[model samples]
Target: MVLGRQRRQIMKILIAIDSFKGSLSSKEAGEAIKSGILRVIPDAEVLISPLADGGEGTVETLVEALGGSLETVRVKGPLFQEAEAHYGILSDSQYSPKDEKLAVMEMSQASGITLVSPEERNPLKTGSYGVGEMILDAYHKGCRRFLIGIGGSATNDGGIGMLSALGFRFSKENGEEISPIGEGLKDLAGIENASVPEGLLQCSFQIACDVENPLYGENGASLIYGFQKGGNKELLSQMDLWMKHYSELVKEYNPAANPEAPGSGAAGGLGFAFRSFLQGELKSGVSLILEETKLSKKMQGADLVITGEGRLDEQSAMGKAPIGVAKLAKTQGIPVIAFAGTVTEGAKACNQAGIDAYFPILREITTLEDAMNKETAKQNLADTVEQAIRLYRLQHKKQ
Candidate 1:
């Protein structure tokens, strides 16, 4: 494998890869890819740009990319248990006023499915109150603009839990206050928001969402995602009906709440909550992250852009971070290559999404458990990247 003159010419390469869940972080994966590129071309100029798609690593990715600090606070967990949650705050200098701080939050930190045990994965019992706590924590720290990634939720509460944390009240028909949870939605007869934190009204929110499911229906939150949160047939039906009822009640309080709005079903109705209560604007996660990372500026004179995720499959073609990066690079006529932990069926769809080529980072045949081992994944990622770059050079030399 040799590049010779080609290797010297192709000096600038950018790596903006997503985290490999349960394995490497976005920064770690980018470093591994960089190590591989360095192995093939020792002097190649490599830039490591960590990324995420509004999922687990979103807060960290944006913080790292924009040079921010993470603030951790004790917040209510999905099951109403105490848990430590993290939100990122970019320094004032990173924003326009140079004194205004920006907060980046991933809802998963406070109300994600991973917080619950398999045996206790009941959505009816989960609450997004913790997510609200996280936001308030950031607000107290002087963040007025929030970029929230709402994904991987465990609750089916239609934002009432979150609103509750912010001082909103849900009342029973008899004028009794009820704690907001999936099961409590049916008892909510009235909403009181006059007591909500004053700061909340001044803050702006932007939600990163990827789905377009409405608030309640066959494709909605309860029916489509409740089962994953431990809802059975009967429970799902009840949950769906409750969501419909809750959405209507919310509409009475806020006319802007349209349950038929796209992405209203995301994060179990947290998207609906943000959209209706906070007036948050929904945008694709990858597109938001790329703009935050300034990929357009980074791609200006790059010879190649490399990106990857935990897996490359049909899903990768559906607005995932790697494909989003590839499309951005393609617009500038920059070649984009991706490396994934494994290539599964339907990965060919990535070709149509603007990825010039992709490679699987597997050293040898191995079981799923072995392939996911931290050391094994790191080394394989490096080796596959090294070989792929060599092959790319080899192919280019012929042309």
Candidate 2:
């Protein structure tokens, strides 16, 4: 009797993992997993795509996945100091219309709270002038479509600093321009758009905002987020009152302004600025990223899809990056798996959210610092993926 050997089938796997913050980048994590998949199935086809939730890694992820370039400019920081800010310009035209360019930027690059030290984290003094500079820089580069992440801001100035940078002057009753910071809201009496660039009218902005705080009141920007940005009880109270005044002024300028709108209080009222002044649309970061990357179209012919983030918790089940990927995969009836550095009990919710299975990459007890080390994380992820694929292949063989 002669026995014949069965040939192994090639598997096409698609990966769209978010950056393992403080551990691995999206590209690096994908590559590590790909290495593991190839170890088990040498002939396997694997595609890695960078992913983010429109936060710290959004610009880098989009730039890498879309064949884009990064441009850095010297802009004013939260305290009106010089800071280097970078934005990404997408080279792929499919993401935008003809003769138009898309620029992805994180406001954190310019005026993030992290840019200022604990001692300098005064919401009353910080401003978002650098954010406006970044926009203007991208605009000059012929980018008419802007995707901005408005998280981690250090200012509560209602975006006056940004609007001022774009030539929307704010002045007092005496015709003198205000300081363009949180304190500026106190004396703001008029807004002038005479100096705004004509090209601004042709631009479109999409802001990534997840908060629902209104512009002013108990749940307003000042009262809700001001504490973290260095506001005391007295300062917060004063800032909230000023926010109300500023919102009224804004309503006078544009009657359609809705200070009570969801997300209007985001990024220290930056959401309101974008919506009321720039006519920008506020959207879910995950949804915007998925559409821009066209991940749904890319997953059509894929046999398996893998996604994950740095950590898996209740928040992960709340429509975070990994959940977003899994939900999209489910729409196509594809099997989805996820891996994370650590998995909480709440992560069990992910299984119901479309992830067929989830794995934690830690192979041994380790300190948090050691576990997050890049080299260690890469090796652990590779090992975890290899084992997962082995089990996957065994199940296939049984079928």
lDDT of each: 0.88, 0.92
Span of ten consecutive residues with least summed lDDT in model 2: 1-10
Q: For residues 290-335, could you state the per-residue lDDT of candidate 2 as single tens digits? A: 8888889889878899999999888899889998999999999889
* lDDT, residue 279, model 1: 83
- Assess candidate 1 and give its TM-score to the true structure: 0.87
Give per-residue lDDT, candidate 2, residue 294. Answer: 85
lDDT by residue for model 1 over 305-347, one digit each (tens)?
Answer: 9998999999899889999999999899999999999888799
What global local distance difference test value does model 1 have? 0.88
TM-score of each: 0.87, 0.93
Q: Quick one: best TM-score, which candidate?
A: 2
Off by over 4 Å in 2: 1-10, 397-399
